[model samples]
Target: MTSVVTSETRFVRSGDVDIAYQVVGQGERDIVVGIGWVSHLELLWELPETVHFLRRLQSCGRLILHDARGTGLSDRPARPATIDDLAEDLVAVLDAVGSERAVILGWVDKAAGAIALAARHPERVEALVLGEALATTVARDDHPEGLDPAVIENLAAAVEQGSWGTGALLPAIAPSVAHDPRVAAWWRRWERMSATPNMAAGMLRTLLDLDVRALLPAVTAPTLVLHRSENMLVPSAAVRRLAHDLPDGRLVELPGADLAAFFGDTDALLDEVEEFLTGTRTGADAGRAVLTMLVTDVVGSTALAAELGDHRWNELLDFHHREVRAALARHGGSEIDTAGDGFLAVFALPSRALACAREARERLAAGGLTIRAGLHSAEVVHLGAGVRGLGVHVAARVAASAGPGEIRATGTVADLVAGARAEFEELGEATLSGVPGLCRLTRLVDARGDA
Candidate 1:
């Protein structure tokens, strides 16, 4: 339903509490979303990534998002909610929306309640999709792969000690976007609006205490378990066991470490979900995507060519190209184009792009050829073999502004990779030729560690 707005929140009563929910789009089937920890019904639409994720799910079916009891706009009970209470609240929201059966899309720690519901009332859940989900958070003798109880306890203690509204949890949830100033600001407000410090801490403890391993066999619906290949938050053994125990479950590990389903490679994650539900994959258009553009130019190319003569210069330039290409391949980059004594590439992540730039610089220097590079992150339009957008121009201009052997990045790129091995020194504002206004540029002083 294009007319459906995310801001128009509605309420559904489950027992004495009022659960807040919003509906968007219409399709043959319904998809209900349940996130781990806390979430704000309206705040979920603030970020572009989150909006895109919700829309992608909507593309395949009618989407339902609700705030569980004790969090967000829902009534915060004095006591914490249990798995049974959460299941009832979910059912209440489904009934309010007139959904007979819907695909339960649960994320991270919230999957326990969804699993319990699926087992208890299989008729209400058509299918299940769990992303970065854990059957249990605490380690048991039978499930030793689960998280240490002490670690979760320490985290809950920190949450109780005034760490709720400061955006401290963003890194563990979505490290890719946590360092971004805009994202950090939005997250701080999200945390404050979702729950108070005590409420969040209590929820953490309750979620950790939940164990749904015994319910796996009773969940008769087809299940898809999606996990990130490099996710550091959840142990791989726990996820593997989750898939193994489910009667009809299949595991697919995608590429990324962000535990938050809306961040990282959301399009890839959605592809799997859509295919599982619809039996076919109608993927998002690749015409435009948020990518990091990297541009590199050799220093004094014309003069050096004249000094070394055409034959020798050609050999060195050829070696430089080979070295740069090698670096790109090593750092997970796609070479978009190459101009005279210059190269252009793009990376899905800003950290990888930064590392590629650094590696290329060092490789070229070793070969007696020095280069300057620039990186910028933005939405670029892909046409034919190359990309076209103001972002590409900004990257080229930034590269032109860099000195020999220097790697420069726009503020957008720098902000995205703040916690990575890279470090930047602000170069203030520069008039990027042909682009509008002044752009803040940061010099990549060091990007030497593993990204």
Candidate 2:
């Protein structure tokens, strides 16, 4: 049995405030993790399960853990909290540790910050593991089963009022252990170790309002996204969407309803995280071939560009890029590459890639830029940079065959999409170019009723 590694707390000064961190294990490779908002490093160490999880990870390499500002042992700075500031705090902790680069593991809202740090300083991030991560929250406006604006406002108001003790925010935020006694106790303890209600409210507000969906493709490190299938606060679909959008990301769906990392069977989570970090379980390139592929393009972008002229068209294209990229990130569609006015994306799950394409087309329609998308599932070649194989070519052909503002998918894609909450209109069979045989086509339609 591996013994508990002795951990020592250390402080690093960043500007006017001091950031606290703990070091565990000892190895050539270092892993610096940025804990989620409202964490107490000392308190977390006391939990047997949490300790076990950390120890398991520590066995692989040295671990550098730190608390975010305004929470736990870290000195709270008067500056307004942003994801950048949180990342800087981690950087300060790393600088003090005398390490140049380290693997980063970020949970919950820290996902965005982790990606930001990785994007800004790729050299400092050897690898990245994001738990329940997202590039942004801009999709909240069009979330399939998201909370109503009024409900969200009321919950935010209650969090602002009662802060940690408020029952309203706890259920939605930590649905995994909303009813479990032990889990609830642990949550309460951790909440108390951090800031008061107002500060908690501020953190919650930042989480809800901040949107960084466009940055998914900018991340430079190999990333692993662990999303719970039953997460209630952030819909499982939303997390699925995130997996599809990241340039170098893979999604592993764990079975659990609890959002908190320590609430569920942490061993399984640690196993996945460890395998990804250490490259013990066949690196990111060795995943199976059954995945969804989505290809999208503007219907008449050349004509639109010619009519609008270079100046206005450039501005419009920028807006289009921002909107489309945001949608891909929100829906978890990794932007493989962009054509003149098209995007090629691959997904580990067929349903998510299809859903993301549907959502993108629907949302972009308002901006007068109609998009056609096509999806298919089959064996794919994972080359790290982009996916290859006949399935990708078939999906591309399906996209070319689609009409303006329509989503056309091959028979395989349609079959996988059939049971999803979204509805589609079957367009019957069509012989796709270079494909072996005739393929059935389907067009995605608004499915609010089915949802």
Candidate 3:
């Protein structure tokens, strides 16, 4: 069974504050992950993507995950925390774990603290890795690399009044998984658990005001700076400057606009990190993969069963099941489950799944029966002789939303089967129950101009 990770979280005294930290896996080398802005050590494990990312990192080295002072489970600073405080908090965690030297992978504002530690306490930092690293947040006349002051202002406003605790900012940070209801809901709770609206806004302002450009030159550790090519917040030229300013820095610009490291194309991001840390990029787990899902349900099955009585309905259902099994075999789909008058199956190719769904609906219609089908492509956890994941839930929801004799799919299905000669009619956005946000649904039309 695929389950969310739970670790024994502990706290260490960092000056006057108690910083919460979790140690995962055991290795000769240690990896201190500096998650920036806001985070909750326990709530983050609720996300499957984060679990996968952490497990992969554990494969490479021991992971030292912690929430910064004044955030998550840590004690709030009596005064506005400074960059010096952030660096010291990290050092304190290292001491608690007995890690004399470790690779520091800093993200966003936390990168400033990492750079400070590398410069101030060079012996403790074995190597440095940064993602979406910031040199300066506010633009200045002397430093053309800084961000526009308005950008930070708008963000502060969002956290303070607009969308704090709602996960509305997820789209801006991680657009790739914005449509997934499970992730959306978890992120909403994560936001709430991380900090209150006022405290979050205050932390945002404090972190943005941090400037680490001066410390870059003093970092003696070999540094790898990773930044997204189409980052929404940080300008590419500015990140390039950050790399150039560092004495022993190497810059690698990855694809995607998501500022969060574990969001879009996570495998690609992890590949880089693992290679940089251990000189080998570990392969992904064999049990997890992206698969296209198809779910079909007989419309008004209860009424039909009542009208036809037990014997007649049973005979008809048996025929329908046989036909569906034949269709699955013909299209290379693996039938995962059959619940009452519904069928759930998975296909390796989106086009094949679409074709099978269309064929099964047509076959059932010809037999005086009709089914509404839904298709979606997403990552799935392969269970013993079956599969499960958010994609399966999404497919079931899409199927439920379809009209009788109609086929519907998420926008992702349309994107995946682009050249399959499939026609799709926009069904617009829908607010599915149990799903956090609106999802874009599309009606799949038959290629032969048949409804």
Candidate 4:
């Protein structure tokens, strides 16, 4: 069967309501796909970037796409729709298409329905992929910080007003879009075609009130949780919690913060998803390893900022940021986070981390920037975004102890580096404040030597 064009609208009978859908690709493998709220299949195809991502997925297998009720071409049934109803729509669509079982790919708000379906009817779902998912609308009661109610209210109002196109919504959805004229225009057009302000607001509220923490363990199918390390929409901790709660779920952290799947590095996302679904990649066996952690910071950044003034300082800081980022990329170090004038990064190998730190310090010194770096190796929690553990903390502390243009390493790291044929001097065992017990540190090179 030839795939339906985006503009071609069709409907599946779901009891009393007709749910609108579009079929794409003609592969034998069937996949039922659900997009987040406010999707216009036709409009989506008009955007080359969005269509490219969809077409690529279609090339691998058939894609069954649908608009959830109350948005797009689907019948806007009344208020207070639950994920259960949304899941029912999915089942109805499958029944209409005569698909016995298929992989389910759901993004953003639809993640709740995807989870609910996988939990309720494991027989119908072969595998599952949820991107930018949320476990609960209200953070766990144990969560120390929940989203501010005022902020949520304002966001809702903005969506309600249909001001998402002009206001912060555009810039917020894809921050990097502002830098690219073509992409920015496409985003604005896509948003306009997708949903009205009220519809968007309603869906936003639906997502906010949703909490699927209780349904996680019931999910039996192989599941992949795709999230960006820097996602501003959903908290990283929440995604971590989802992985922890799901019985067969694995996490893959993509690099960019663009919440829209089609916006950034979609090829990587597709590869990971396909690999997980097929037997080629086992999420359990891959990505788990002990690695060296590194933290680096500009020396006297506040003082320098004051000296250079805000604009000039920001300009210089931008240059510094680019330099450090390029150095990290060249050395195979994954940047974890950027805080003011500092960075947190990780390398899978201790030697790489050590070498990268030395290179970074040397490179920055030439740029009129002074840097200190610390490295440690321990059983690091590889969250795909960055490494975390006591080892990471120790590395940060050691970096703090180092003077400008110096590199330091914890005793654990030093031990790993002992036979690596690198020159180093012991800094002696010292009581690291807040860290338990004494830590032996080594200075990779004396500060004066670099001078």
Candidate 5:
């Protein structure tokens, strides 16, 4: 079992104000967490969900949590918050912690600050992760999902009227758990202690007119955007625009409405982040759940090795590697390993894995090689290298049982993608080696027949 990381609360001087920051774990890499508004360095540990999130982030690297100026234990700045102030504060915190370069993770409207920092100081940031980020707070001519002008004005007025705190905001931010009295009280207290009502109002007014869309193109770091499917605070459409506007950005729409990442379906959200940051999924929380697995085997490897000399065979293998990697990229699959001439990979959705398998088979055939692939969607343990459990064994057996130039999958995958641009032919139940009972297998057929 991995030990829990201990975080130390400290303060760093940025400009005229002191910024409160915390550093957890001792991993070589650095991941700076700048959730921006409403934070208290000591009080944040009171919430179990947030504590879990920080610990998980520490598992990836040395997690750096900070309360930006005008919020939490940090000193209030002299003037209203601007993009440059937030960016400069971020740099100061990084310098204080001795982090030369780090991955920046930001949430909601505050994410723009991190985005701006990455755009302006590319040398200080390695990558970026934005959750439910908003480029603009008010509705623009192109983005209709942003908050209405009337609503934004009303929000500024309400904050000025001392109507700021989780008691008034938790329902809108995390409706899934807003009804729970205990949850509400905890968040309310945290929000109240974060900042004075007047300070909160000034911050809200500053953000109302802020827009960072122009900085999207200037950001050179790789980025990932995670948005909730039914999020009300930040519309899913806005999240889509953020992903599209930013260069080298990938969007993942998780299932939930909670603007707070520590709410519903938090594990799925964190698992994706961990994998993206560390190139491995240390799935400590997501146990044996529904997962998609893809197994591929190059047909007639012995014959090919004999036909082509040793050096030429190795070259052909390299070509095969390129072909499969390209296919995986097109289909959103992660290559697990290349065991001999066979490849093992996984995907968040079964359709993608099946598409990659069929595409790879066709592309390999063009290069005078035949491949047999199998896919299965089942409960499996996700480790760093590849998945474990009986499901993986069954998938490997299914691939070996497949005929040359064929793509096979389990019935579960067929059921999952029934309405997609694909179908499956049931091949009856077959007893797989090193498995319990007989499992039903199916061959994938794209809309255009015999994929």
Candidate 6:
């Protein structure tokens, strides 16, 4: 199916927050894509996985996409938004878009909003498609599939420590593509653009504590609950319980570890989603993707700039920039973006990322500059405009941990470049702040003791 092209973002008033929304199709029915995943509506099209999923749904009916209160392009409320607020916000979004009825499709974690709306305002919902559904999040003996409070708290801590909008949660959410530089880079951008770390943490805590099992039985519309057999974030049994509880719900177990509805066998997801919503299906494929990334930034650049003075600093910065760009091009690295004196770039191979980092540092150091570089290679979503998802966040954090003039990389990158001329020293395991789990870091060194 041909995906929807980029379009302008419009807004509707939902209390104080201006809920951003967009409509992509003019089919006979309406399907409101309830807020799910950390989102940015405009950037969603930039991802093929989401575009494919959305386009297939559009074929079934008109598709309504929106930023929930306090996230994406929507206005931030003075206080943290509640599940009730997000649910009602969906109602206002439907009304604003003139959607009297829609198949409310909710993604994981946000599934409660869809359930709440359907239960209280059944008149507004034609049906429901809940992927990665959960009636309650906190774990219990009977509901062992639910998220544990400690796990939730750890995630909250990671977010608080500046990991929320940077795809720091990628490994937990979608390990299948966790390190893909293309997918990871764009995901990192989404994190930064989605919401502040504090707001995200508060929102997560509120959502985690919310239990809406009582509301499930009240939903009058036909329902479909699709859960991955191996989704790490949300267990399959939890979705099974959800399916059994909803008055008119049916369950379909998909095969994959990816938690994102748009990643991993997206066609299967949209197949079930479209079939449930419109009683038909169009198998839209989310095609191939994988990427490797290396992010470099000058250590103490501000102090260096001050000491060097403006004129000399600008000249030096320009020289470093030109030299780095040349080194990257030489090593088949694509310039992803530049932030001040630093560069965020990509390579098709871990060796290239390593080589470019080494070459760039060597050239810069000779000119009296020092730099820090980080490398990691993994699966990613290669959106034509840009790459996105988890890999970039890990790489950025890895880069931040490096000492001056050192090139630090994850074991994943080092393993990938094994047998290449590059030499590596094990830095052992350390908790990558804002990232879940400890990581085995390694430093890439040349024989002369430079990155």
Better of 1 and 4 by lDDT: 1
- The lowest-lDDT stretch of 10 consecutive residues in candidate 4 is 279-288
Candidate 3 shows a clash count of 0
Q: After superposition, how far is residue 323 of candidate 3 from its true place, in Å?
A: 25
Per-residue error for 190 in candidate 2, Å, reads: 1.6
Which lDDT tens digits does candidate 4 get at residues 243-351?
7678998999889887778777776787787677664433322334687788999999999999999999999889888988887888798888899889998887878
lDDT of each: 0.86, 0.74, 0.84, 0.76, 0.81, 0.81
Give all candidate RMSDs, comma-separated.
15.7, 23.6, 9.3, 13.2, 17.9, 11.0
- Score residue 318 of candidate 6 by CA lDDT: 96
lDDT of 5 by residue, 367-396 (tens): 988999988888875443456667788779
Model 5 spans > 4 angstroms off = 142-145, 286-451
Please name the candidate that would achieve the greatest TM-score relative to the true structure: 3
Query: Per-residue lDDT tens digits of candidate 6, residues 107-166?
Result: 875688888999999999998888888888876656666766777778989999978767
For every model shown, the clashing-pair count is 2, 10, 0, 0, 0, 16
Q: How close to the true structure is residue 163 of candidate 6, measured as C-alpha lDDT? A: 80
Provide the lDDT at 242 for model 3.
81
Show model 6 residue runs off by greater than 4 Å: 1-3, 140-145, 285-451
Tell me the TM-score of each prediction against the true structure: 0.66, 0.57, 0.67, 0.59, 0.62, 0.62
Clashes of 6: 16
TM-score: the better of candidates 1 and 2: 1
Off by over 4 Å in 1: 1-4, 286-451
Q: Is candidate 1 or candidate 5 better by TM-score?
A: 1
lDDT (Cα) of model 6: 0.81
lDDT of 5 at 112: 83
- The candidate, 3 or 5, that scores higher on lDDT is 3
